[model samples]
Target: MFTFEAEFFPDLTKTSVSEFCGEELSVLLHTLRRNGQLIEQLWNLVEQNGAIKLYCIAPEEDALEPRHFNRYGLEALSAVLQKSVRPPVFRVIGKTVGLSDACACENSEYYVLFSNFAAEYSPVSCGDCNLPVPLYKLPGENEDEFYALRQWQGEYKACDSLFVLSGVGEKFGYREISEVDSSLTRDGCDVCREMSQKCNRPFYYFLHRHISPLETCPRCGQEWGLDEKLHGFYAFKCDHCRLLSDSP
Candidate 1:
């Protein structure tokens, strides 16, 4: 048997409680835990309104579902609600600027963190070459900019970061005009060419001003740039022996 602690705003109206049961509630809880101001406000709200007893239960171990894995267990329910519900209950909560809305706004501000994580960690491969491609959505690009890029490219691919893509382009000689002209292609890689054509600039132009420091091999002290290949896995190829190792 397992027991979990559940907490809720005591003065929540029935409607608010119902709304909180799904995605809004999960987003709110995550925001509250992350934002210090919201946590203080939550404590103050509880102190003024008094605590409400919702329910208590201990379920048998065999009866537990996958959703129960999280300490709060609300996230699993929230995921289901987000799919079925339209516009999300949290949008309404945001408009009200109430206790819940404050937390939601904070959560919205940090949503890009998740986007960055997805860009870096998600499995991505080039459609034409079938090789793993490093793609990134640069920070400060809003949803509108993302959509505009997709529209310009005439196809949609799930890359958010431009820096990683630029790095890949530089390594493959795709962004160099001389190489493109010699090869009779605008870019070396199909993916790089598509992005360069859409942006009206060479892919290498997106490379960060400061290059990443070359990693030094522990065994031989050889320096090399990290490269991604074959389904987005990373490997460092030693400059000395051309040996490939997973770690530098």
Candidate 2:
């Protein structure tokens, strides 16, 4: 069962975003890791441990449709658990209503769970994030969700203050690190692109399914590897529908 019995998140402004989108996204995932699951073994090794994070960004007003690309995080964790890598952490970040910068949320602080890798573990590199992410254009379609490459600030790594509870958690104690390159990704997924007439970010899997380069788009009931190639992709899933989706 997936359970999160923790409280807290990190400070995004002080720690800020990094220069690269991948690192920034990781840091974002780091903060959103507030209340999620963790693997049992990894849980024992890190100062704080649990499931890894999964994130999706969009106009605060838009509602998100799941994707296939999103499956990797969980699949990787499931593998770790099967191999007993350790209790992993999950940092799921969603943008409901974005403001300008960290103050965008005002004095109201945000939070996420944080954890460390096991002592006998290897750093798992988030693989090639080349797939597109779906932009939620439902509510904030008029706002024009923006994008940028961000990083954490220098000399001010006070992000740890958000989750420094005594028994609840402990700091990773790595370094006064600063800046993590993050992509201000908004509706970068494919399904969103098709609807927007190619005027937006890249497209990604909605309610993602792990398709080997050989697998098919689950929504399309497409057994591309088995018989065809999912040339005309689709959105969400309906296993009952036999690899088809109900996406708009």
TM-score of each candidate structure, all chains considered together: 0.17, 0.18
Residue-wise C-alpha lDDT for candidate 2, range 19-74, written one tens digit per residue: 21234333323222211111212221111222223333222221111221133334
lDDT of 1 by residue, 123-209 (tens): 222223322222221223222323333232221122223323665544433222212132312212343334444433333211111
State the local distance difference test value for candidate 2.
0.24
lDDT of 1 at 61: 23
Clashing pairs in 1: 136-160, 136-161, 136-162, 137-160, 137-161
Candidate achieving the largest TM-score: 2
Task: Give RMSD to native, each candidate.
Answer: 18.2, 22.3
